[model samples]
Target: MSETAREAILTRIRTGLAQPAPLPPRPDFTAPVHPPLAGDDEVLAFAQSFQGAGGEFYYCETRAQLAVQLATFRERQQLGRPFVWEPAMQEILRAAGVAFQADETEFLAHADWGLTSCEALVARTGSVLVSAASASGRRLSIYPDQHVVLARPSQVVAEIGDALRVMQQRYGTALPSMVSLTTGPSRTADIEKTLVLGAHGPRRISLFLLEDE
Candidate 1:
């Protein structure tokens, strides 16, 4: 065969061997209504219930208050102190015992845990979705033994659809690298129909509800 023909045949063979599979369809999203903010006592009660399940909850009136609570938790949890936040939070974390690093590489390499703000929470399921585009690494929510999330009462939606719509509007064509629908801690019941926790993700999930602030 001529060199050109030989090359053509080889190219055809390679193409034939390659898999041509259609991509999975994007998730269908339907916006749902926001849920009314849980009463302070109700929120507190929910947190108390999770305590028995190895979870913690904190309530704050403002972002400042939440940051302070987080700092304290990090210290108590021995998750290393945070040094700097993006802006207003940096100092608070530093004071609480967090050591700041220069970049994400350092953040993950040394930090024992992480904290991020959430877009919304589903009151119906008590689930929260954290987006990677929000500058929060997926690992922050998954890799750590403990995950601390900050959510506002106003962001509590009635269903997952509401959260998805907020995401669609925020990111448009470019979806976040990851969207985690976290409800409680990771758990599984695979052995003898026995329930187990922390199978694939954090053993503990903490949420700070900022209502007034």
Candidate 2:
């Protein structure tokens, strides 16, 4: 080979060697078997985790019991009209003789409580899976002083994977704009490492689980 040709080939080889090699593909675990969804076990696990994360859990079997619970809660907290985002909640409030408004965002801003239905309550992590596309908007869950969730026993799932499957079955290929997995109230220890509640969202989160079918 001519000297110029040999040097050109060496320069090309050197340039290729200087480039970094690509990283390997991430590994995927083999399909692991998970236990069947046990209703009682799931509820127990969720309650434990929820209370541990500073959340209040109320289990009621009847509507009358729920009404009484709300009445006591209202009297103790001295809460006025609450902002309700879901139709089911509106119906419940009307039946319970409680006042609620869904007219505007300003109402929700000053509202003491915000009521909404969750897509799923995850047992493994005690998370409430919420979708922006649902009746409960993004603000309803985050803006109110107290974020109240009205969930049914049928909505409770075994794990996050099951919760995701529920969403998939609900929305199909069309997904929501935003999905949140809230485990507890809005808390942060960012500043000075001192914990603070209601820093970025509601100070308190309460879940009212209904044993309704």
lDDT, each prediction: 0.67, 0.83
Q: What is the C-alpha RMSD of each candidate to the true structure, in Å?
A: 14.9, 8.0
Worst 10 residues of 2 by lDDT: 30-39
Error of 2 at 176 (Å): 0.9
lDDT of 2 by residue, 15-61 (tens): 98999689898765765455654556778888877888888999878
Clash count of each predicted structure: 10, 0
**Model 2 ranges off by over 4 Å:** 1-28, 31-40, 105-109
What clash pairs does model 2 have?
none
TM-scores of the models, in the order given: 0.63, 0.79
Please give the lDDT score for candidate 2. 0.83
Q: Which stretches of candidate 1 lie over 4 Å from their true place?
A: 1-55, 82-110, 211-213
Cα error, candidate 1, residue 174 (Å): 2.1
